[model samples]
Target: MPYYMFQWKYKNEAVKALVQTPQDRAAELRKVVQAFGGRLHEFFFAFGDYDGVSIVEFPNNERCAACATTLTGAGANDLFRTTVLLTGDEAKAALAMANATNPDYAPPTGYTHHS
Candidate 1:
């Protein structure tokens, strides 16, 4: 299973709804993730650009995409924007591959220094 981080900012309506009906959103979130054969590791509310974040593990990207699509399609799209995150190990592997390739490019001869 691959891990993912989902970050979101709540819309005004969502905030209002939460105020009106305070609930254990983590439980609801867990159910959603479980329905897709995934596990919700952590869910948290924060003070920042994003209203909340969730760490989850799913079978693959397609399952993750399905979860996001289902949430967004079912009116959540109006209430939040979601971002997918990658792990440090995944990034490191990508960097290693890039370094192995060592792509190089030449600047155009007409290019001039601005600084």
Candidate 2:
């Protein structure tokens, strides 16, 4: 499974709706995520740049994208973004792969540069 980090800011209409009738948004999100074969690990209400953030896991990128886009299709949020996340071990493995394949890759040195 692949993990994703999402941050979102609600539009004024969305804020009004939630305030008018506060509900468990996480539970609602879980329903949608489960339909897409994904799981919500954490959802938090935050301050500053983003109003909220969440971590989710899906079988793959396609499923993750589908779920995320569908959830935001209602025009409730003003700003929304989803980003892929890698575990420490996975990052280490990527570094090792880059090292192993370094020999086959070369940078262009045709242009002159002034120091």
Q: Which has the greatest TM-score? A: 2
lDDT of each candidate versus the true structure: 0.81, 0.90
Each candidate structure's TM-score, on Cα atoms with residue i matched to residue i, is 0.77, 0.87
Please report, as a residue range, the 10-residue window in candidate 2 with the lowest summed lDDT. Answer: 105-114
Error of 2 at 74 (Å): 1.3
Q: Give a tens-digit lDDT track for model 1, residues 1-115.
A: 8888887776778789899999898998898889999999999998987788889999988988888777766664344544566689988998899989887866898998898
Among the numbered candidates, top lDDT falls to 2
Whole-model lDDT, candidate 2? 0.90
Backbone-clash count (model 2) = 0
